[model samples]
Every structure is written in structure tokens, then in C-alpha cells.
Target: MTDQVEERVLSIFREKFHKPEVTIDSSFAELGIDSLDTIEALFEIEEEFGISIPDDAARSLNTFREVVAGVEKLLAEQRIANPPAAAGPDAAEEGR
Candidate 1:
């Protein structure tokens, strides 16, 4: 799940910032990403992932890795109530 989110995020950054080599651990500060760009990036991420990151949470993001981590955590919690069921007849019986 984290990997998927990370990949999506990196892709977003590449398109938004025109930097194709961005990695999960890249430092936003070192990369020279400004506040407006960060906000735009967040917006794009929310739209792409179908998630709303609170303003407070968005403010705490300092690095690319943190952003990915935040998204990963949000996605994990969102799936808590929808765990996948096992396969086969026994699984169908358990759902009753």
C-alpha cells in the first residue's frame, strides 16, 4: 500500500515539478520546493488519491518522505473496516 502511494506521489511530483528523478526520501527543502508549490502538490495528491489531508497535517510535511508517510497512514486507516475476505466456500459462509 505504501509503495503504491509512494509511486503515485513521485509521479505527481515529477509532473508538477518537472523532476523525474524524485525519490521517496527526497528532501523538499533541498529540492527548493516553495510553499505554493507544496500546496499545489498537496492538492494534486488529494485529487489523485481521493483523500483530503487536513490543513494541519499538510503543514507538518517537511520532506517528500513525510508526505508519502502521511498519505500511507491515511490510506491504511481508511481501509481498516474493509479488510479483504478469504477465498472459497468457507469465506462465503463466514460472511453470513
Candidate 2:
């Protein structure tokens, strides 16, 4: 899940900042990403993940890892009730 989110985020950054070399550990400043661009990319991330990151939390993200971690945390919290079910007949039966 983290990998998936990271990939999506990287894609967003690539398109937003025109920096295809961005990596998981890349800091926004290191990638030449300004606050405005970061905010725009964060908006894109929210749209892609269907999650709302509070203003304070959004402001706190400085690196790719932070963004991915924040998204994963939000996703985990959101999925608490609808935790992913395993595949197969046994898993379905357990739900019942």
C-alpha cells in the first residue's frame, strides 16, 4: 500500500514539477519544489487518494517519505471499519 501511494505521489510530482528524477527520499526543496507547487501537488494527492489532509498536516510534509507516510496513515485510519479482506472462499465465509 505504501509503495502504491508513493508511486502515485511521485507521478503527481513528476507532472506538477517536471521533475521525473524525484524519489521517495527527495525533499521538496531538493527537487526545486516551492510552497505553491507543493500545495498544488498536495491537492492532486488528496484528489487521487480521496483523502483530506488537514492544513497543518499538509504543511508539515517536507519529503516524499513524509507524504507517503501521511497518506498511508490517513488511509489506515479511514479503513479501520472496512479493513481489507483476504481472498478466497474461507475469507468470505469468515465475514459471514
Give the clashing pairs for model 2: none
| Per-residue alpha-carbon lDDT of candidate 2 for residues 1-96, written as tens digits (9 for 90 to 100) | 777888998999988778889999899998788888889998998899889999999889899999999999899887774556775456689878
Error of 2 at 16 (Å): 1.4
Clashes of each: 0, 0
How would you encode candidate 1's per-residue C-alpha lDDT over 1-96 as one tens digit per residue?
767888999999988899987888787887788888999999999998878899999888988889998998777776564545664455689878
TM-score of 2: 0.82
Number of the predicted model whose lDDT against the real structure is largest: 2
| TM-score of candidate 1 versus the correct structure, residues matched by position | 0.80
Model 2: per-residue Cα lDDT at residue 5? 84
